[model samples]
Target: MKIYLAPMEGLLDHLLRDMLTRTPGVDICVTEFVRVSGSLLPNRTFQRIAPELLHGSRTPSGVPVRVQLLGSDPACLAENAAKLAELAPMAIDLNFGCPAKTVNRHRGGAVLLDEPELLHEIVSSVRRAVPAAVPVTAKMRLGYNDRTRMLDCAHALTSAGAAELVVHARTKADGYKPPAYWHEIGRIREAVTVPVIANGEIWAVDDYVQCQLESGCDDVMLGRGIVADPGLAARIKGLPAPDWDAIKPLLAAFWDDVLIYILPKYQAGRLKQWLNYLKRIHPEAGIAFEHIKTVKDADVIGAWLAEGCPVPAAEPGWTKA
Candidate 1:
């Protein structure tokens, strides 16, 4: 099965991509969603989200990174998509899955799911704007308020020339709630001709099995799951889980990279947001989290995590969904 890394706005930056790619079974990485509206953003903005584009749309380890666009305007999106295509990304993914209230208020992200025809126009325009060699794909939730119009939206994107679709298996109202409803994703795959990737609440290898069985999709994309366990994708591919001895040195290396790349650039709170995920895999992460809660300095927090925080054990029968 193919394992694609989900684009988490704060957590999945270039440094994180470099860290995770060293682990096995990671096929592709989608950069954090880039908002497209009005004018195209500056080159540094695109370069920051997708530095891999500088390396010709692939990571130093040779893993491909796709740029994702989130917006409501077809004309603006198409224009910006063309500009980004010039940089030669591996692919362009449309985002109709984010449930952020600010984004929805602007008629972008999940709100677009409510307007299937408009979604078609946006996807079709973007598809036509880019070269044929550059694949255009989409990621979406079931619907805005309900799953009633989910398949219709999927069919709309597919017919509009979307090369692939990743269904998050939740409605806008659901908002990361329990029960991902992979069955609904299976229904979408049956309805559309393009490849469908099941995404939502997959935290472990067993959940991968259940999601595949339920959605009948050959690939799975992870968001929170990968954050919770860095070795998750590798484990799902039948590789041995990273033991504490191996995990320690790897996390130490990740801390060094984060301190150099992520800390100085972001505010203390944003840095803490990243540690909230990194702590999941590190030994003594709980202590590190407490340290982060009280410490405002990135260096202090990094020192705490590096000083050997005890890793929390995974709860029995735990699953992200």
Candidate 2:
């Protein structure tokens, strides 16, 4: 099955994408949605979100990165999509799945699910603007406030010429709560002709298996799961998980990459954010997070990481079958 990485707005930026894609089992990485507003965005704007476009649209490890756009305007979304296509992205993904209230209040993200025809118009416009070879895909939740229009939304996207559809199995009201409705994805997959990819709440190899079984989808997307455990994709594929010693270097490498690619002031927060996720899976990560959660200086965090967090020799009970 193909495993794609979800485009988590604040967490899964290009820097993190660079680190995760290098670990293997990640087929494609989508950029955080570039909000297309009143006018067509400039070339620089697209580049800022997806610098991989300049390098064959692939991460350094050669994984393809698709550019994702989020907006409510059909013409404006199409115009920006056309501009992004000019840069030769692996693919263009439309975001109809984001659940942020601020985004929804502005007529973007999951709120658009309430308007199926608008979804069709927006997808159709962009599909027509971009070259046929350049695939245009979309992501969406079950519905805005309920599942009343779930099939309609799925049909709208596919009928509008979307090459693929990714369904995050929850309504806007569900937010990031547990017990993702994986079975609900099966219903949508059965209703849509286009390839359906199931996403949401997949945290481990077992969760991946159960999601595929329940959703009836051959493909799956990883989000916060990957952030919490960098070796999850590998483990899902039956590859050995990276040992703590091996992971320490990757953390350092990520730090180095962030320092070089991002501004100094923003660097510490990024590392802290990643640590917050990591702590869920690694005890050592919890200790590390506590150590640097309050420190705003990137240099101090780097020094702490360089010293290495302590990881136990035995596997945690939660990881066993």
User: Which candidate ranks first by lDDT, i.e. highest?
Assistant: 2
Worst 10 residues of 2 by lDDT: 312-321
Question: Per-residue lDDT of 170-219 in model 1, one digit per residue for the tens?
Answer: 99999998889999999999999889999999988899999999999879
How far does residue 226 in candidate 1 sit from its true spot (Å)? 1.0
TM-score of 1: 0.88
What root-mean-square deviation over C-alphas does model 2 reach? 5.5
lDDT of each: 0.82, 0.88
For candidate 2, lDDT tens digit of each residue in 87-152?
A: 999999999999999999999999999999999999999999999889999999999999999999
How much is the lDDT of residue 294 in candidate 2? 64
Per-model TM-score versus the true fold? 0.88, 0.93
Clashes of 1: 6
